[model samples]
Target chain A: EIVEALIRGAGPSSLEGVRVLLTAGPTREPVDPVRFLGNRSSGRMGYALAESLADLGARVVLVSGPTALSMPRVHERIGVETALEMHAAVMSRVADCDLFVATAAVADYRPERPADGKIKKSAEGLTLRLVRNPDILSEVAALDPAPFTVGFAAETERVADYALGKLRDKRLDMIAANLVGGERGGFERDENALSVFWPEGSRDLPMMSKTRLAAELAALIAERYRERHAAST
Target chain B: EIVEALIRGAGPSSLEGVRVLLTAGPTREPVDPVRFLGNRSSGRMGYALAESLADLGARVVLVSGPTALSMPRVHERIGVETALEMHAAVMSRVADCDLFVATAAVADYRPERPADGKIKKSAEGLTLRLVRNPDILSEVAALDPAPFTVGFAAETERVADYALGKLRDKRLDMIAANLVGGERGGFERDENALSVFWPEGSRDLPMMSKTRLAAELAALIAERYRERHAAST
Candidate 1:
């Protein structure tokens, strides 16, 4: 109990008694029985964020994709493989959450017709038709009494501009943007820096370990969430 | 030194002083900076095989794809991400080796033109044009003084037929076939069963832990390798 209290005091515990829905990792889109379309996300950042939110006394329900990471000590965890499965998992439970954070790098498109068997290398060339997947974040934000929605943007270029556009277009309460495909911290790395944006202002969190960064981001999120509630009441 | 002798005595050390070129894990074909076409190989079997071969006193050069597995104790490990890279690494080293084992589930096709930047999710649908990758196993066996080549066939159905066809078609000395996409013993599983075939005969290795299976398979490989050399002499 003392240890828990100390941890709570270290960061803003304004999220006490709040329920959070968090999604992490990259979703795989099947091409065949063995092959799929995947990404480089290691799920370290989002898993650390889940722990940080739980430390601030929030009840965290984590929806995860296929990752090598062990489950975090959150209230619950729902494992899904594809974007469709993740969307279903989140939509089924988002009604009870006080906040929603989408950190999953869900596939934008999936093979339109996945082969039932393994494809043989008989052809000289092949063409795969892909169809767009549903936007999970936009759907959650469109809820009648939506929770304080937060989105994450991983861009190779124009990080801030893309993040701001997402924040405005998705009607999210906040957005965290980061540059990927660089030598520095990003996917598959333990450390990262994020540009956080809200309706009124924005802040830059410097490069640091994902664990430390998560705690700081959690504190900022708590402050903004409290202020939004205060304004509404 | 004592431990090494004990390990060698436990299994056939017939491979002592032999040079081996082996490939393991699934190669990733990049769709873009962030997304890739990947398979379900976990690299456990191949890594275990590398250790088992090393235990028998062979100098193992492992050309591997991206895997979460730690580097196995071997003479050398060449890490690669794509099928083309793996092919280059193997082809450059195969001439110096006496035995070649192709265990990697290399992609049959890669995107014809991979995008320079992360592709935005603007279109409702997209078509990806893929071109066939170089057949690494076939090329290795086609060498004038080709080493004793062993291939792996991962099939969802007709396991034995495919294994034999590949063995004959690729002119390989041996082929190990296993069923994937099943409920038991295949890709991503620590335990597996292999149907090993040679020109004269075939053997069925029952389901067991990959480590033990590797040791058994290595012994069989050593026996066949010696037989082929003696016949040639």
Candidate 2:
């Protein structure tokens, strides 16, 4: 199996000292204690990423939103909810990391004024005031000593075009694309398909199990990281 | 929510009917009763697509492989394993579809001889015969009456270059790219980020819940599908 082969390739002593930072799951924007805006993100993809990175022998720091996924082995796991909390967590320790990945479905907009308690339901139509959340990926990418930064683009049409624009706009080193709309294989599904892209080129990992993809992705990341590092040095 | 705003913008009842075909998850190639080869895919992204399509009032046909996700409510659902199975399933019914998305992660290789029973482990490391699997996306794209085809790429580096390469090699109408690393977001995590690309331009979804991204992707897909359809006609 490729997993077995990959394990062998790493040897017992390989990847012992690598460091990585990752974010996972969905962020909640509270409108009231009983009401909040959120998306249906299970954090599975982020969990799998952490596992794969750990397997590669990287000491990982996982900053997560609320998710059912168990903490991956070999990582410092921190849990948070709101986008602000995530931002704080990420910023606090982003330095000294070799890689940074932002996978959390962070709420782009949050209620400007969160109600202290359950909002009373009235006959009148409710209007909400929202403000934009911080752009986590962009913020990290703009860092002085940014680790290899990667972003993702999940689009329905003009997937390639839009993704490339994001890479340039966000100033990301790379990006991934997810095509939603399938039967049993999208959000909340156990399988997925990914397309990876960079400024110069791109490749498709096709659809596969997330676990396997994570491993392959980790190896590829290691190789690329080394190449970029080598080139810079 | 953006959904409410979009629907309102479309003028309630404007989208009574539409059709879409989406592929999701990762194909598996069996080597024995206990062993099979597959890609790392969580199917979350595709499921998100289905959800967004449904929300937009499209009657969706979702073709998928094995995944842990529940099937999004749709007009039709077909499930299969292996690339060959998925290829047959897609070809059997793709003729009438209005839009086609090749999102499933199909195995590139399969064991030539799948053991009827679990193969006994031998003292010496055994080499299993391998063969190439059919490229389902490319095959469908080559169809005489091809539906609007969209392809995906998951790469570690040079995402744009590689994605563009796939666009040419596979002859796809569009492509999306995702880089896998950091957290579990790429494969199994609920939240994901994306970069949408095509021949013309690109955009970045940034990090967000797959569900939210799915909605945006669907809107874009629907818009582009209409444009492409109109151009062809």
Which whole-number lDDT from 0 to 100 does residue B7 have in model 2? 66
Top model number, lDDT: 1
Model 1: colliding residue pairs: none
CA deviation > 4 Å runs, candidate 1: A1-13, B1-13
Each candidate structure's TM-score, on Cα atoms with residue i matched to residue i, is 0.95, 0.49
Report the TM-score measured on chain A for model 1.
0.95
Question: Which digits, one per residue and each the tens of the lDDT, describe model 1 over residues A1-233?
Answer: 99986775644446889999999999999999999999988888999999998988899999999999998989999999999999999999999999999999999999999999999889999999999999999999999999999999999999999999999999999999999989779899989999999999999999999999999998889989988988999
CAPRI tier for the interface of model 2: incorrect
